[model samples]
Target: MQDVKADVYVPGHGPILKGASALDRHIKFYKDLRNIIKDAINDNIEATKISVPDTFGEPDEGRKNMTVETWLKFYG
Candidate 1:
């Protein structure tokens, strides 16, 4: 996104985002989530015990457990 120099971003979901700052925030979000899951795996945290930060934005409650399960399947 930074290399492309786009003025706006159309995400897979949610409202349309504008500006580079929006892209930066999106990048940070995924990076943060990846790191959190990685750390949890390293610490031997159970999939059922892993948690996302409350401040990470409003995620779908129904998909939260599935997300953790998918992450563990690939990275665990």
Candidate 2:
């Protein structure tokens, strides 16, 4: 969406985001997640240990987060 310079985004869930703040937050979430995965991989950590909720020590409040198992399925 950012590549296209979208002015608004309507996600599958929730209301339409009308500005950049929401988009920024969305991007930050993915960036953080990717960093966590990268760091774990670099440290030679096992894929089964990489879990979103476990890494954060709490459940995600609203978003549907992915598991490391899913990441391995795609990027392994």
Candidate 3:
């Protein structure tokens, strides 16, 4: 918010919000990403949480890789 001096913002997967609601989605997004990556790691398809959409940092070297859909199912 500081970057834009704005009070509200819309998250990637949810609706826009102007106050605590915005914060709620932000936190959930992080938690969701965490679970997603954890599942990937458990399944041996390494992944990590990140700020930007489809923009995770380097994941651990793995023997195989998969599509985002696969990750979502694993994550869900």
- TM-scores of all models? 0.72, 0.54, 0.39
The per-prediction tally of clashing pairs is 0, 0, 0
TM-score of 3: 0.39
What ranking emerges by lDDT with the best candidate at the front? 1, 2, 3
In model 1, what is the error at residue 6, expressed in angstroms?
1.4
Which is the winner by lDDT between candidate 2 and candidate 3?
2
Highest TM-score against the true fold, candidate: 1
Clashing pairs in 3: none
Off by over 4 Å in 3: 1-17, 46-76
Give model 1 RMSD, 1 decimal. Answer: 2.4
Model 2, 2-76: lDDT tens digits are 665677988776568777777777677657767777777778788656655333355553332445655555555
lDDT of 1 at 52: 65
Error of 1 at 2 (Å): 1.4
lDDT of each: 0.77, 0.63, 0.52
Q: Which candidate number has the best lDDT?
A: 1
Pick the winner on TM-score between candidates 2 and 3.
Answer: 2
Residue pairs that clash (backbone atoms under 3 angstroms), model 1: none
Arrange candidates by TM-score, descending: 1, 2, 3
The 10-residue segment with the lowest total lDDT in model 1: 53-62
lDDT of 3: 0.52
lDDT of 1 at 44: 90
